[model samples]
Target: MRIVAIANQKGGVGKTTTAVNLGAALAELGRRVLIIDLDPQANATSSFGLQGVEDISLYEPLLGGALVTEKIFPTQREGLFIVPADLDLAGAEVEIARMPNHLTRLAETLKPLQEDETFDFVFLDCPPSLGILMSNALAAADELLTPIQCEYFALEGLVKIVRLVEQVRDSGANKRLELAGIVMTMFDGRTNLSEQVVAEVRQHFGERVYETVIPRSVRLSEAPSFGKSILEYAPSGAAAQAYRALAREFIQRHSPPAARALEAPEQ
Candidate 1:
């Protein structure tokens, strides 16, 4: 399975939105997808109309207290599942501060799934901060996908994330965690500024920037308010189409890993 962490240290950049929509879009394409909402806000969890907190959550599992499987819950959509989050996760930063190897807790918890080949793709929606939660998510991921908003601040904030990725690499917490790609979100075609931002990011990242740019559509913003993805809320809208294109881009880029492995000679 290919695990991806949709992360950015900046808030309101469509990070959770990309997580929910891309997960849904991949599921729609006949791939088994799981979304692990690492954000304490639980926006990814709430986006699917799920808001429950009894015992199990990322907080419990990462604290080395609960099994990861125990926190997994089926979402409203078929082929899509989520390991929901809760308010308790907000305290994890403080709680894990005193613990050893805290940054690798998420990677340890996800080991079983990776070994057993449980799902086709796992998307981690990290919190908008450079805290323990984000570290754990980064350490556990195979690749990091950053959703850049079409604005001036987007590139400025991205430099910090690049530095964090470099730190993770130097620390050897998942040396394979590469910069997967960047998706430009909330794009406005009418604005030259939006076009310039996209051009600049693409110039910096080169092929790491995706061809699919998510437009600033009202439907994309409105879906989460109703606890749904654009696909479920307005499947025919530009936002949904953008998400579909993203899924296609993701699969097209990473599907080779599976195929190449299958073709390798047996030991």
Candidate 2:
């Protein structure tokens, strides 16, 4: 199994949205996907129609109260699962900072899950900040996927995250952690600014940037309010189709050979 931290210190960049919809899209394709909503806001939790019920989040697990696996809750999707978060998670950060090997706490907490390989992919939906939770996530992930919005200052935020990944590796937190992919979100087809941003980012990152750019659509923005993913709420819309295409490209690039062999073309 692979653990991917979907993070961006810059807010409104589609990090949580990507985690919810992209994870749902992969589960729709028969992949067992687990999302750990590391953000205290619990946006991912609400995105799936779940309330951030007390004692059901990673807050307890991170603080050494309960097993993280015990917190897993199934969503409406057959194979998609999540460990929701609550406002209490905001306090876990302050407490975790005072603990030993503080940075590796998440990694240690996730060791058994990683060994179990229960899911094909584990997506850690990080908060839009360079806080303890994000640091812990960076230390535990095999890969970092940053969702960058198509706007001014996009590259600035991308640079900070890239440096953070390097620091995570250099500090012996997780040497294997790599910036695996850059997802461009909120792409407005009618705007030259959006096109320009994508072209500029491509020029620098090349293939590291996925070709499937998520479009700016009302449907995409509205899905989370209804506690659904774009694939479920707007399957025929451009944003949904874009995410589905992204899942295909991502699987081809990152999935094991055996998993790849099982992949079928999109319907």
Q: Number of the top candidate by TM-score?
A: 2
lDDT of 1 at 30: 86
In model 2, the clashing pairs are none
Give model 2's TM-score versus the native structure: 0.95
Q: Show the colliding residue pairs in model 1.
A: none
| Model 2 lDDT tens row, 13-100 | 8999999999999998889999999998999999988974887899988988888899999998999999999999999999999998
TM-score per candidate: 0.94, 0.95
CA lDDT of 45 in candidate 2?
A: 96
Worst 10 residues of 1 by lDDT: 48-57
For model 1, what is the error of residue 113's alpha carbon versus the real structure, in angstroms, after optimal superposition? 1.1
Candidate 2 has an lDDT of: 0.91
Question: So what's the TM-score on candidate 1?
Answer: 0.94
Model 1 residue 191 CA deviation in Å: 0.9
Ten contiguous residues with the weakest lDDT in model 2? 258-267
Off by over 4 Å in 2: 257-267
